[model samples]
Target: MAGSKTATLYRMVMPDHLCPSGLKAKWLLEREGYTVEDHPLRTREETEAFKAKHEVSYTPQAWIGDKRIGGYTELRKHFGRKQLEKGETTYRPVIALFTMTLLMALAAAWVATGEPLTILSAEWFVSFSMCVLAFLKVRDVESFSTMFLNYDLLARRWVPYGYIYPFAEGLAGVLMTAKILPWISVPVALFIGTVGAVSVIKAVYIDKRAIKCACVGGDSNVPLGFVSLTENLFMIGMGLWMGFNAFA
Candidate 1:
């Protein structure tokens, strides 16, 4: 018997819990009218074999019509060329963790110096507040799945970005708290804040329409507008704090 109309297969091997870009690609592909066969490769051997066969080493290795598109950016470009687009959303986990770490660092610094009115204290308060907001905005895994399903968005594409953002933030916090990389903390914090601000602004620009936020996991249902605004404000405040300290 001939294969059914949905016989087309698009393969994707995403690292576990780290595949925002890959997810976005998958979402876009399905939206563009394609069947996607997604598998999360957990082991290094699995990743290597897949890469050797496909001539690519990446979380989101896409095979469409005998052509392999490596990585989220490539998939994005491919989807764009086809004139099929989904709303761009920032990865939440990473942003949240990053914000959390920054806040923790500030709090620690304040404790160490015993100065509640110092720049470090201000930074701590700001970071703490943003972290709280980030946590509040987190979307549950189920909601994330739903958002992608509704929009044909991929899980791999945006998930990794979300993971990375927080990983950086957390790492910076550890460094700051441990005094292992004290010299770099302020600069790194400033950079993170700037990048975050820019990212939020870009999201607002890309999707002018009000949409459901996949910020936290699926559990939290917040409007995108408020989340975006809050994110921007937090980042801006962090940036300003960092700049003020640097110049002072």
Candidate 2:
């Protein structure tokens, strides 16, 4: 069946410009083990003529035998793929932010104590990551709150908790960063983290509901699973550590 499959890709590749979506369409067809008949619409006239001939409004048109597949997005759908035009979410944003926060913590630690990595660097990493996550939540609290309400037990019980959660996180992060008032910071982090972990567990494991996590706020695409659960667990650990160190 693979050997019998053939695809035709008509794309725009001009002297000064190449249509990215067009290039992507061609790659997709070739990657799928299809014999691709590549056609370049190099000029405005050629592109218009092709579009008119195929009754298409777009340049990146694909054809499998006699079937016309639309653009890059349409071709992905045709091939049974769930992805963004660029790509699907793989917790990349969360990973990038956390990695950068860790680096920042190391840099700050190096400046203060002449050491790049130390026990304190972990503390800084948690605090800085919390601040960044809080910012994502606060950016669109309405959206974040809406997504949170879907699975957060407390948010469902008390709608205002959704609105206040971001502020509470930011406050805890700020306090943690300054290493001041451990009493306030520890409890805040502990309370929120516990609730969040429980909510994620119940939603994802117990109820087996697939849902979007509001970890990075309302605009997030992060799924409720290992990564989200780990985030809450980290907070719980941080809160306990800070509390122990504060009195110890």
Best by TM-score: 2
User: What C-alpha RMSD separates each model from the true structure?
Assistant: 16.5, 5.4
lDDT, residue 25, candidate 2: 89
Tell me model 2's lDDT, rounded to 2 decimals. Answer: 0.89
Write down the lDDT of every candidate, Cα atoms only: 0.53, 0.89
Residue-wise C-alpha lDDT for candidate 2, range 18-85, written one tens digit per residue: 99998888888878889888889899999999889878888788889898888899999999997664
What value of lDDT does candidate 1 attain over all alpha carbons? 0.53
Candidate number achieving the greatest lDDT relative to the actual structure? 2
**Minimal lDDT window, size 10, model 1:** 1-10
Which TM-score value belongs to model 1?
0.37
Candidate 2, number of clashes: 1
Summarize candidate 1's per-residue lDDT along 1-248 as a digit string, tens digits: 22221212224444555556666776776776666666766666776787787676566677665666666677667666633235444445546655665666566766788654566655565555444444433324344455423221223345544434443444544444343444465565566556554544545556555555544444434445556456546655655555565556
